[model samples]
Target: MKKYCAYVLLGLAVISNAALAKEAPLVSIPTHDAFFNAIKAHCGKAFQGKVSKDNVGNTFGNAKLVMHVRKCTDSEIQIPFHVGDDASRTWILAKTGAGLMLKHDHRNEDGSFHSSTMYGGHTVDEGFPQVQSFPADVYSKALFIESGIAASTDNVWQMMIYPSRFSYRLIRPAREVQVDFDLENPIATPSAPWGYE
Candidate 1:
């Protein structure tokens, strides 16, 4: 029965292929959860930072810089970035359902919101656990355009955290600003940010 043998061989091949598919290991991409947890690991700590690279100009020349990982929640982390005595900026990192968001919260000395505040970006992909990059979002681009800094529309901000150091960086067409903080040495926590206080 040649016809019967052919049917049996076809069935066997199909079953074999199904078995192989079931035995194959699944490959998964690195998730935002890993990246979020990496920064959460350093809550309630403060570190001093210095401008490591500034190709644009000396915007923060010789000013004492500090970042305090002050407030943390299950879905958010707030870091106050202080430069000298000017404690008007805070970095808010939040876990969105799709990915992550980084927002800059700027305030005046009297705890009033600045006109050009709450501008940042969202992650477009599942970034690495040690580092993440956020391209300027629509809101940020609109704010930049409205504020006459349209060149910042192409901005991409990046943050890196490791066992020994942490870094915050900004990149655009002709501008690159980077600040590195020593994680191994914890510094005294600074005062609350302008709006937070």
Candidate 2:
């Protein structure tokens, strides 16, 4: 019967489509896992850094910078980015089932969270082992709007981990900032970042 043959053909098409779907890989698995592992290799180590690029002003042009890969867990890494005597910033990288999350932890001298703290982005697609990009997430957008820094809502932050250098970068339409650290020659570890001690 022609009707029976049509049903059989439809079933075959459906089965083939399901097979194709199974063959396609999810966007955020293997690549992000490698990146996470590469960064984890430097756990508990602190590295000194310097500003390599900044178009917003001279905020970090002449400051002594440091980044401590201080605390590490199976799912998250806490790195304190210190500029001169200001230990008010910490960068958090977290691995989630969906993708990676990047957060900024800002604190006061007395270890209190600032009004603009914990604002950051999340990785939406596959990224290479040496580089990962994060676009502003919901929380960051909301915080920026509330704090009157709404321009940051479209910010894209990047991190680069290489054999001898690690860099943190920020990119937006009209602003860009980058900081590079010498991984092969780390200086003496500084005091614990604010809010950690």
Candidate 3:
């Protein structure tokens, strides 16, 4: 009877070990998001510009945004300088049945709040501008305020493109802000011209 009990316990332990070995690693995805794989899929370069607004209830500025995509892994991108101050890493976590997204932990310098309507769209097909409308993967209202630099997202992230690069501007919604940069030939080393972070 003692020998039989020992065999049963051994079998149970082996089964438990096997189960644990077969588990997959955890993938992080925030509950709410703002942008998706919009710029990456459409624009083949990093966005290095700014979006600002001005008088008469109108606002606009030079918008510089840089996003890169890494295959089979999370993105390591630099928004550079979106708001007023150094750049902050906004984690756009990986998701299933969807693409890249922006993590919503809104905090900036001076303890102020900034909320914007975020949308993500990409050019799935390449032929002409009148080919087909891009599918907006995700959208959200995001607020980025003041927080310590070390308090950013603590997870692996990915950009929207492989070797990502492009720049654009909102220039106050309902208008197209100009983007000026070398889409074909980007600098050998990525740079933060606006000096965000």
Candidate 4:
């Protein structure tokens, strides 16, 4: 009789747990697909940008900043970031199945890879459709440490796309840089990025 009672109680507990699990609500979070589509919507265009904020210093002071959505594929988008006459930087956004990845491809005037190139991060969460943030990933941290810029190990890059504006931002412990582009006004597409031409 005692064994029967214990078995009944265990069955009841299992049923109650299953009931509770079924009653749990579903959560909906913004996805990388949405964010990627948001930026992909502006492909094949060029826009002018300005240094909106730079607490570290005016590294791009007064330079004519431009961003061109140069190439787009099903799984990747490459945007060349032009600062004045220098066109050695490209922002590559690619879908990693699990999430999105952001990589900075830097090249020299002769189309050679820079010492600190191809360093970026991957999204670790369901960021919003208009914005996605990527914290420094393992590769980026190691690259920073090896390149003697260990302070960049904590870098977090963010990209925001809206109807009229798009922003690229970099955040670290003591550094913050942002550039906002005017999407409302499309500019002539600049020359291809280094090694991309």
Candidate 5:
């Protein structure tokens, strides 16, 4: 088992709040398909409310999760290569009969890649960590408290993914706050980031 290191975020604040409360393109209703990178372009200005925390304090603050879609001979996936000051993590995406899912190729602080699938499933609980399946591994209950989004009662599922490694705890689908971050890069990614041969 290869141990992949983890990633962390940098800072927060600054930049007008204009794009703060924006919302990413809603996950289109899908059931099964190849990977797509154009969705990565969706990284621009979007997200509703502010990000608060994720995976303890591993991935928070202002960071962008820039990603692009690519296809392989046997599979299609999304490669989200996040650049942060402390840590960075990547994600691989695929579509199944259930919906869009990440492969769970994350690394541990001790530098060990995931032994099993951290992502990929329909109802989330199907996977090991569970608590996900909606927006991939971006917002898992384990990830939320792990990163630093433990401030409010908002769950990690309502977090945003770009312009800043931030997550939001939705109070009423209208009220939220930017999340936190860890201190490691390449922390985890079900799939893989770009340029990882």
Candidate 6:
């Protein structure tokens, strides 16, 4: 009888474990969150990047580019984009009920917002896990026009993640810019970006 009781207790323990496992979620988020998860995977790392394509010469082609996947939360991520010694740009990604929203935060060295700051777009379609694109939003278009950069009204930004590289790209009728970074080799984090501690 004692041996029979031991067997029943062992079975009960196994059943309990199974029940506990079922109560816990198998994944933190749904499967459709692939693109967002891909970007979130490198939360605390910083990577050096180079200009892969620049149809128009600007500060980007001449400066050293580094992208830091800095502050992150469940619904928001802030990545600082450094060009040489300038820390004036940050890319903000936020999850919304419909899709993702991308915003740019441009600040002066003294932590003041620039005249043409906080312009960006939102994801319009269901992009793949490896890539996502944001088209200029209504506010962004208006801001561009008001800021006297009317040509930027038609801007679109895209981000892609691969096994060994991450890319940031800008597409417009007259301009195309892309920067590629090595994901497999991350360098030391640079100094805190300007306007940030």
- Comparing 2 and 4 by TM-score, which wins? 4
Best by lDDT: 4
Clash number by candidate, in order: 0, 0, 38, 0, 67, 0
Residues 34-64, candidate 1, lDDT per residue (tens digit)?
A: 7677778889999999898999678797799
Candidates' C-alpha lDDT = 0.89, 0.87, 0.34, 0.90, 0.36, 0.85
What's the CA RMSD for each of the models? Answer: 10.9, 8.1, 10.6, 9.4, 20.2, 11.0
TM-score of 5: 0.34
Query: Where is model 6 poorest over a 10-residue stretch in terms of lDDT?
Result: 23-32
Instruction: Give the distance in Å from residue 43's predicted Cα in candidate 4 to where it truly belongs.
Output: 1.1
Residues 1-197 of candidate 6: C-alpha lDDT, one tens digit per residue: 99999999999999999988774332323422787778789988999998888888674657888999998887788899999999899999888757788899999878899877778898887787888899999999999888888999999999998889999999999899999999999988877776667
lDDT string, candidate 2, 1-197, tens digits: 99999999999999999998774343458878788777888987888887788897786757788999888887889899988888899999998668899999999878989988998898978888889999999989998999898999989999999999999999999899998989998777778877776
- lDDT per residue for candidate 5 within 22-138, as digits (tens), equals 654434332222113333433222222223433344344555433323333223343443444222344555545344455435554444654432532233433221123343244
- Itemize residue pairs with steric clashes in candidate 6: none
Task: List, residue by residue over 1-197, the lDDT tens digit for candidate 4.
Answer: 99999999999999999998773332334477777877888899999999888997888978899999989986799999999999999999998767889999999889999998999998888988889999999998999999898999999999999999999999988899999999999999998987887
- Candidate 2, position 147, lDDT: 87
Between the candidate structures 1 and 5, which one is better when assessed by lDDT? 1
- Score residue 137 of candidate 1 by CA lDDT: 97
Model 2, residue 23: distance off in Å is 27
The estimated TM-scores of all candidates read 0.83, 0.83, 0.34, 0.83, 0.34, 0.82
Give the lowest summed-lDDT range of ten residues in model 3.
149-158
Off by over 4 Å in 6: 1-32
Model 5 worst lDDT run, 10 consecutive residues: 1-10
Give stretches of model 3 more than 4 Å off.
25-46, 50-63, 68-85, 95-197
Model 4's number of clashes is 0
Better of 2 and 3 by lDDT: 2
Off by over 4 Å in 4: 1-30
